[model samples]
Target chain A: MGQQALCYDGTWKGLLSLIFDVYAYKYSISAIVTENNAIQSLLFTSALIHVVTEDIKSARVTKGIITSVGKKGYLELYHVFLSEKEGRELLILRTVQYYLGVKEQASKNYAHADVLEVKKIVKSVSRERHRMKAFIRFQLLKDGVYFAIAEPDFNVLPLISKHFKDRYADQKWIIYDVKRKYGLFYDGGEVQEIEFGTENRLDQKSISLAGHESEILYSTLWNQYFKSVNIRERKNLKLHIQHVPKRYWKYLNEKIEMGG
Target chain B: MGSRIQEKLSILADAAKYDVSCSSSGSDRKNKDKGLGNTGAGICHTYTEDGRCVSLLKILLTNHCIFDCAYCVSRRSNDVKRAAFTVQEVVDLTINFYRRNYIEGLFLSSGIFQNADFTMERLVRIAKKLRKEHNFNGYIHLKTIPGASEELIFEAGLYADRLSINLEIPTEAGLKLLAPEKNHREMIHPIKYISNRILQTKEEKKIIKSTPKFAPAGQSTQMIIGAAKESDLQIVHAAQYFYTHYKMKRVYYSGYVPISNDLRLPAIGTEVPLVRENRLYQTDWLLRFYGFEADEIVNDMNPLLDLDIDPKLSWALRNMDRFPVDVNRAPYEMILRIPGVGVRSAKKILAARNFEKLRLEHLQKLGIAMNKAKYFISCHGYIQRYADQQSERIKHFILSGSSSKYVKAVSTQLNLF
Candidate 1:
């Protein structure tokens, strides 16, 4: 007859379990919905809704993807989930279908529609990861810990923690993603994930609470150095904006005086 | 911007901007538990308005000089304000700027003061204090003063990651004309001294465990382009000699920016040959990475590069009798000759084609710039109908994208660095 509709809890594991149900019940799924997205409960429809998030089923599906496409492909699947694109769940499900249906290796066959869609999302996430490495500048706090706040367009904190952890091993630092309401803290030993309480949003006062007295002195020196190094004989604002866009001004200490 | 340190930074930084080598790569140093910084794959924290990469605290120890070079802004005859930083001031500025993530490390050069040995001694002391006293482990690129003693040159290499001595003019005749005080032998002496020590240490490190690294990033040098009447072939020959003989890591080409109105130099308002500078860089890349020789790019017949097309595309158009190679079966070297296929895509095509024959659509998905590569290659499903077309028509087709409006807009004006 027709395909059935399934609702999940909108997690990576929850989506994997839904995939397991698709094979177990031998019924094609028309759509997948999370709880936040209210689905209409219409009458006289061939729909089977369930909250089936079995740990065993999710683990099996993850193992199958790893065995088929190697470790790099597995990471691309995770990146697809972390993306903020709408209807990414269904797009990921279709990619899994294309991977299993083909006889030859499908991930290398970029001509496939499902593979192309997933690679596009992976490219976007990796671009954000590179920009984070280039644009994230830390400020010295009063407690000797360097702190900075960034609101990247993608969820890239997990992807960029190792870079800072290796480079700044002798100091303590915290990179708080204000938009995601979480932070990554490296306290001279190891990295840990932290979260602020629900009531307090990161504001101006909270950002400078741990500021040392000499922080302003160093910042002004940096601003002066930034202006001094610029060769006015060949000034091109177009190229400068291309590398450091306007959206990332707040995170950069030197660009703050430019007033965006 | 009017503080004492700010004043010195402006003067010193402006004096040092003409040296177009700001790279912090070629050395991989890890941070010790007590240190505050480490080096990675050359992070450019910021780009100047000229689009040049700024990875290090590029500044001079002092602007006081004893010699007068006609093209130099910091020549002794020029009436610019004089400034100098103390040894402690440079160490502190580097540490603080590095701690705040403003730069990767320090690039300290200076105008000759009193004598070559005296000036070299001061530069070595600043690097020594940073390494031994402060326990810093970041990238340090020091400019080696000509005629310094062998003992001091060896000591500087022990602390610095990379050392360089600029060959400002390509030929000895050009050097004699523009820079009266400098000769080719004095400049090449330090480069050879540093290169021999680097080789000697490589052998020592293999046997002894605690030998201590010496200039692990190797050495690089820069030559000013368009400052004199040297041909492109002459410049490429000089670069090839450096790469083959000196084992140079890189050769940077700086388009000469006019500064003075001396009869020996161009007028102050003369335009910088930026396009020729870019073409020379492309030719240098071919020598270092693309398995092309110096004579293959510019010969006696073609003494200069065609400023309209890049060096690689120019090579391909001249040798079009070797076109229409099968992408599904061509070797990796041949695949690299295609106009749009870079090093990355060439490797990808080699790996992907073993499983199945590739098509035009598959090539597009693999990130090939098809608009340019379509005229030179064939696949399982597609071949260029214009493969036998005249070279001029094919060149126009390839360059039509830029010839429409993009090249016209930037032809007269200087492009980004």
Candidate 2:
């Protein structure tokens, strides 16, 4: 009726299904948040009801949005959802609302605030996804499962799963996001979302398989090769840090000064 | 690998760092048969302290050159540690590094150990072993040896994603001054042979369909800057020649890091001409993507690029009549010509301006550099603010107005070419 927060299950499809009902039932809501997220906001100052996720309704909304703005624009909106930033749900609704109000395509309307904001957010999310692809460093364990741990700034583990799965189709590898405490494990045939140890503080030794000789050898060779290729006359630590930021130094085998 | 292999890797990788072509892109090598790798746009896996990308495990098969090229560090006369890797050792290193995600793939170059064909054969053997024995689908780039037979180069193209031969100097006269035996004709022979074979193979593939891609990434070359007496004009003309003649994918400009104390070249402490190198690269970008001819950027009239401003902005300043371009009405080409607008910003303008007349807010929102762009472009209801300003004043306004952070960065880091 009045302005209220609507809670959806913790998924992009759930949000789309919730938006579908928001339009179909004419429900007035201030924010569309995850059921877990809505609890925090509802405790202070809003009314909310759990919206069940329906595959059929979500499919209808997906088609409607695709018809308004093409697949490329739809992907831009989806990347904003994957970003999971503050006020992201509201921004998506507004951009959808603006496009639905117009006859012409509103995706490229930089003159409008909502469209421009979506462009900015999509760029940032795309950058994080690309960085995850680049910064992921896999270490070979004794069991021969190539293991890597990343704590990206965003929830990009889900975004980069297909890339790793496709590239290393022959090998078994696991990419664990310590911050999210979830991982994607590819077992040579298919990928499965997994959960590793409780703390996510996998100090190098915890993951390093015992008596695995080649792991240490390759890591050492990598660190040595990294240092050797640098031209001392052109040493620019500032530029190096900009490309491989300080926050990711711990995760990378070459960036670590010394380790197991 | 053992400690012996590690030591050899250090020596050979250190020796090979000067080549500076680390890209592992432009290859259509797909991962079939559930094997190792597939290349898309290249990834820079790590950066060195010098801020150069370590995309590939760029290493040499051996550092045992017989030539005494003055600018080269591994010259026969220069006293540096020498090491060699057996073909099997190189294959193991590449496969293992690739598995651990430490690199895109292998970039194998070598110092001439014996005659040209012998050295070229060794390089090809390493590539062939990786592709055939291991079923590796990784990006491989090999350096074409000067005076090597066409058969070796052809074998290399079948395995390597890309092949390159370094011109080493901008002009024949400059090359002869430093390295007496080397000439442009010798380098051109290999490039011509490869280009011709690439064309013939491409034609055969149209009919055969299973011709098995022959160097899908195409060939590229590198020339050292600040090594010899050559102007910006000569350097650009040489690049233009390669682009026109061979359809070269890229021409790398590696600034001369004083590696040898040769009497024929600059003293060891001579500055690296980093600013000049950066400008030349910016000019290179214009030639490749920004619809600019080499002569337009630098000609007989103006042989040197301006150090204070970028080449694009310098061009816009010199051609003063082209300013105040209408944002909404101008075609995509004219919008691209605006000094501060990059390819991304130019595309955004073309897409966004179709709905309505672009205003100041819209232009800023599109992420074009408004600090420099505002003087050159006009939008809805906005008159040119500095209409009658001279080129010198505009250049100063653009430079001094830019953040001090950029100017400070130029001193330390070499900009990407």
Candidate 3:
């Protein structure tokens, strides 16, 4: 199958160049690889190569995939690329390209299995987005910076900004997507991206915030509340663990001091 | 006093955990002009290790009591360490917790300390301090002491969002045997008094705009299920009485967890019957929201909720003549009688069918779970074949797996927490 070896400025324009080359090739392309990182090196052996140019007309045609699907779809495509699922990157590109061609008639053929598959993936992502809103727990860090760690099934961190920002307008907070290795930090006004470097440890003991009196008092009170609320007669340890999994207990204030 | 406060909070909060009326809904007051008040959808600031929502600063004024309620951990004769929070201590904790947004407000219930009036006065003082001295407009749900006077009950309504007077047992004999200090008259009198005051306040509000909201969120009561020999029908009847007579916003059913070794209560080996509680809640929803009456749901003949199936489905099976409700022509109330159709699905069917004569496909598109609804409803002259041909067999088939599915759904949601 015909392939493209495209290199652009690591921007949407660069991605669009690759999309334009797919159609221009006039041969159904097998894959497109970015040259800066040798992504999927072994798979590129039998593929044909075509260099991408900064052609505005071609780029605009390619950008139409984003315009047709809206921003949510565009971000999903980005996540699909980041997910590194086998053939996912190619599938997203192909899906976007297919969506661009049949934007208007997409809803008419609801019975089609391909459309159903796309809808399921989109819906699953949306569900995870909503679940994160319900489950995200924030902890008070040493610097009075409220921090929370989440490992959602999908890339939901980007979607959670509007909620946290609105609800906690006065507080400085950081919500780290531990699985994604990146976090969003809001400094009481605006949010910015922060990366947890390779040396950054995930151990709770290592990141201790020593002298926050209110945090300590709150933690103690929470522990008191937790101890008090459990009905001894109806103590179902199995059911309790089932509800609040031991996995999430590390960051939970009530469960933090009481080691699992 | 400090150690006592901590000890009491620990024991009482543990005791009070099973009481699930801590939900703060219905009130719309926001942080008015700078004083700390929030009317947002109540935030659950903490989750216990068991993962239950900690929306309110739930604690008891004291775990010390004069009564020996069989189902209560705080029963006077129990050998557990007892503790009590002084009025100042409770007020301080509430204000401190509220400032930190650690809780919505206080859910203050107490085991009878000294006497009913003394306990009620202490609880009232904490609430008064929170409202007047601190100017707190947060949600507060206080459990009304059964024998507390009308004046204290009035103050409770004035300061709290909701006041609850739990009718601990369904029958008077059960109350007398299990909790001698508490009587049927003591519980009902306060409920009736509060109900009257609530009604009067509402009427007064219509005429006078400046009148304060008296229990704006309204009153609710709890009934301990599985403790006494009361059937689900009798329990539901009590709930109906509270709903109609007392004008209670909710009748919370807490499955009896036998905490004391009293022969008067159910055996300790018996499970709390959470499924029974769930079934009761579903039936209660039908009563309040779905317009199903109590006696029609569970009569003296059919006294117990069929543990195998939901009350709605069981009702549908018994009245098989009402089967094959024509979805297109049936009213909203009639459509609600269909087994799988919930309030939302019924509304959707009404809205969608108005546009066109609904087929099975149209019903599915409206998000009705067709597997359950098909046996109960007909669409565009299409009736379920087995619904009439093998009615008994179909009923058994539906009833068998309903409880398992109900358990699974609850377990799955619990996992999400």
Candidate 4:
């Protein structure tokens, strides 16, 4: 039973390093939480222990996971971690500890609650990742860089970065997560994470000030195309709203009412 | 948007909305040259008011037609504002929309303005310019104009990702009754030619390293449902013909939306309930993925689909002798036939059962709908009691159990597409 809690930095590598220390230090943790979550962990249990993050420890745990569960299984664990769902760290740490002990592909054992939850959480995260890719609406700025703002449900920027980089290899673009306050900038050659801080977060007016002369024309044309393709006979607002939910409509070019 | 180009776009897009082959999958085109976009699984950029996927910039070259088909909105006799986009306009629109991630790619269809050859050449020219001039590698679905010269249609396969020629009506008699000028013979020729050419190109590529790709996403076609007095069995037979003969990626069954008051077609204001269109799609899925044949879904005896339940449930209800399948021992094919077990759940059952015997709890964990599947399957923890009941009693039990108000509302929505 994990009565005493172990805390580390809120990073994937930090979790892995904690798993490394779990065996080295021989500390039985009742719960695995981030130091960022340490203040709230006291509500459940008063005892909180903070551990240092070490690169060598995390690297060893990473190799062990890949060797035991394979590449796809490792990514599933990473997505479950990234999902930051309630009690996710404890669920993964326990399942992985059990999987490392067994030779069979125990991570895929749906009979166990931990294995099933990992799959379910990964599926939801992957769905959100796909929705982000489909719903990203970019604007052509005056500086010749395409810019878009996304507010996804999960921390999916790391997941979708490769898809955008490979598909839009020629263009310079930035996809900034407004909620996360961090953005990814791909300048035709490299992808770099950039931050605007809380106060300097970018807005539409400032973004549009640097927009190209042809930007308005293209967005307006997109809005027009969005309206024209609908068949009136098959109109079902319930289904339409289900496919493209109201939450994503704020950034969609067609959903935004056109100003005449 | 400017008035002139915007006007043409609305006119052409409004004209081309009915041809619903909006899938952007099957193309292995990579953006290797650092061009614009690439194709993978289809992505719906947004949905229309009718809930159809707005994946492609689906528009026409022009809305002015030479032939008058009673089911068509762009018929020569119809009174509408006709407009057309020039070659450059189509190319520019596709590029801009693609760069902004507004659409997957272009779906350029057209009404025959002059002759079939003249119109097809213009459509091909647009595809060529997008590929060679702009290096646009996104999914391009070109409409293969019927009766166009064989060489011209072949050229379209070289540049476009998918090619289609609509059968319009499912059966020959339906085509004759709806449009006397059109015949199944002329429409089927180009599809057959393209199919042969695709196979021939694949054969060449196996030996020669430099052979170019031809319609890498394969082909698809759409048929208007409920237009002619054809039975559902005829529609399923026609769809099976396309899939088996051509190895088609899809055969879209679009419900007949009455646009005109033609005596041969459904009159205006008669709504084609989405339920019928949705049922045909379910039957299509059963045939293609569930190892079920065309005759099994519909036959001379049961020509029409049951409007109350799905085709799979209807088939299961009629053949109740095959119930109470042992999930722990039954094959994947058998598990797929169970009412609530989907393709994904069936695969998961086979995978998870390799480690341990799958029980009712494991099946529920794998996301199988236990409500209906519980009656058909017996696992370690649960045994079916309803399998011994009469067909009518079981049907009524399942139907009433699923008639929650939320389920009733969502069932009306066409989420199957």
Which pairs of residues collide in model 4?
A2-A29, A2-A30, A3-A30, A142-A210, A142-A211
By lDDT, is 2 or 4 better? 4
Give Cα-based local distance difference scores for all models.
Answer: 0.82, 0.86, 0.71, 0.87
- Model 2: residues with Cα > 4 Å off, grouped in runs: A41-46, A197-201, A209-211, B403-417
Error of 2 at A190 (Å): 0.8
> Which pairs of residues have clashing backbones in candidate 2?
none
For lDDT, the strongest prediction is 4
Against the true structure, what is model 2's DockQ? Answer: 0.77
Q: How are the candidates ranked when ordered by TM-score, highest leading?
A: 2, 4, 1, 3
Please estimate how well model 1 matches the true structure, expressed as its whole-model Cα lDDT.
0.82
Better of 3 and 4 by lDDT: 4
Rank by lDDT (best first): 4, 2, 1, 3
Candidate 2 lDDT at A133 equals 83
- Candidate 4 matches the true fold with a TM-score of 0.96
Per-prediction DockQ: 0.47, 0.77, 0.17, 0.77
Docking class of 2: medium
Off by over 4 Å in 1: A1-29, A32-68, A93-107, A198-210, A258-260, B404-406, B409-417
User: What range of 10 consecutive residues in model 3 chain B has the weakest lDDT sum?
Assistant: B408-417
- Tens-digit lDDT track of model 3 for B126-171: 8888778876777888999988988998998888888988887889
